[model samples]
Target: METTSSVADIQMVTFLLGSEEYGVDVMDVREIVDITDVTKVANAPSHVEGVIDLRGSIVPIVSLKKRFGLPEAAAGDYNCIAVMDFAGALTGFVIDEVTDVIRVARRDILPPLELGSEPWMEGILSLGPRLIVVMNLKHLA
Candidate 1:
C-alpha cells in the first residue's frame, strides 16, 4: 500500500461566504477573477449557475451559497469567482470577498467532524481569532 505524505503546513486563500469564512489550498487556485459573462446551462443543478469562457476553455461555475443552502445574497451583491483546479478540471466557485492568504500549520487544523458538517470539508482551521472552514473539493468533484 502506498502511504500518503502528510502536509506539515499549507497556504490557503480565504474568502467569505455569508458570514462564515472558508478556505481552499492556494495551490488548487488557478486565479481569482470578477464574475461576469456566465453563460447559463439548461437542465443543470441549481448550485451550478453556468459556464464561463475562461480565455479559451469553458469552465463551469458553482455557487458555494446554493451548494451549502445558504440564503441568497442581496441583489447586486459583490462577488468574486475563485477559479480552482478540482481533481483536474478548472471550476469556479463564487465567494463574497477574498479575506487573506494564510499559512496554516497541521497542528491548527482540527479533523472534520462527521456530524453537522459537509463531507467536502477537509478540516476546520482554528488560528488566533479566525476560524475557517477548509474545503477539500476534490472529493466532491
Candidate 2:
C-alpha cells in the first residue's frame, strides 16, 4: 500500500456579513451560537452590540455589519454569533450567517490589494467562483 503525505493547508471558518463572504482562522474560533438577547452596555463602541452570558461568563459581542460600516441587518433576520479568541479574550462577532469550514492550500491565499485601507483584512482567497476575505481578529480586537 502506498501512502500520500498530507499537504500544508489552512483551515478557515467562513461567514457572511451583508453580501460579502469573510473568513477567519479556524483555530481562533471557539464556537457558534444562535443570536440571543444581549444586554446593552453603557458608553460602548458603535460596533458593540452588547454583552451576553456564555455559561456564566460574560462575553462582549460586536456587530460585523457596524464594524465594516455596512447597512444594518433587517430586524428578525436569522443571525448567529461566532465566538473567537481575540487578543487572548473571548469575543463574539454577530454575523449574517455561518457558511462552511473549508481547507485551502497556503499558496491559495493572496495579499490584500490597496483598494482603500482595511486594517482588519489580512488576505484574500479565491475558491472557484467565491472570493473570501480573510480577516485578522487581532486588528479587530
Candidate 3:
C-alpha cells in the first residue's frame, strides 16, 4: 500500500472515455471547456480535425479517438476539450468528460506495459481500482 504523502506527490487530471478512465499530467493541461463548435479545415491532416474559434483566435482541435485510431466518436458524446500547450502551440483534445484531479506516487505508478506492442500506451499508473493511462503529450501534441 502507498502512503497518502507519497501519492500526493504526483498529480494527474482524470477523464472518461467510453467506460475507460484515463489521466494526463495536470501541468500539461491549460484549460477545460465544454464542447465547442469546430470548423473543419480542408487539406489538413486526418489527425487534424480542424480549428475552432476559441475566443478570438483559431485553435486546433484533435479528436483523441482519431489520434489513437479508435472508431469515430458519436456526435455529442464529448463534454470537454482539454487544452494543452506544447512547443508553443495550444492544442485541444476532445474527451468524453472531465472527471477529477488526484495525486499518486512515483513509486505507485507503473510503466507502460504495452509499450512494445501499442507504442503509444506511454505508461500505466494504478490509482485505486482505476488505472490511468499516462500519455506522452509531447508526441501527442
- The prediction achieving the highest TM-score against the true structure is 2
Ranking by TM-score: 2, 1, 3
Cα lDDT listed for each candidate = 0.88, 0.89, 0.77
TM-score of 3: 0.84
TM-score of 2: 0.91
The residue pairs in collision within model 1 are: none
Q: For model 1, how does the per-residue alpha-carbon lDDT over 1-141 read when each residue is reduced to its tens digit?
A: 543544677889999998899999899999999978789999999999899999999999998899998998985684889999988999999889999998767778898887887678889998778889999988764
lDDT of 2 by residue, 1-141 (tens): 533433567789999888899999999999999999999999999999899999998999998888888899787684899999989999989998988998887788898899875888888999889999999888874
In candidate 3, how many clashes are counted? 0
Q: What TM-scores do the predictions have?
A: 0.90, 0.91, 0.84
Off by over 4 Å in 1: 1-7
Query: Relative to the unseen true structure, what is the C-alpha lDDT of residue 19 in candidate 2, on a scale of 0 to 100?
Result: 83
- Ten consecutive residues with minimal summed lDDT in candidate 2? 1-10
Q: Of models 1 and 2, which has the larger lDDT? A: 2
- TM-score of candidate 1 against the unseen true structure: 0.90
lDDT of 1 at 2: 42
Score candidate 1 by lDDT. Answer: 0.88
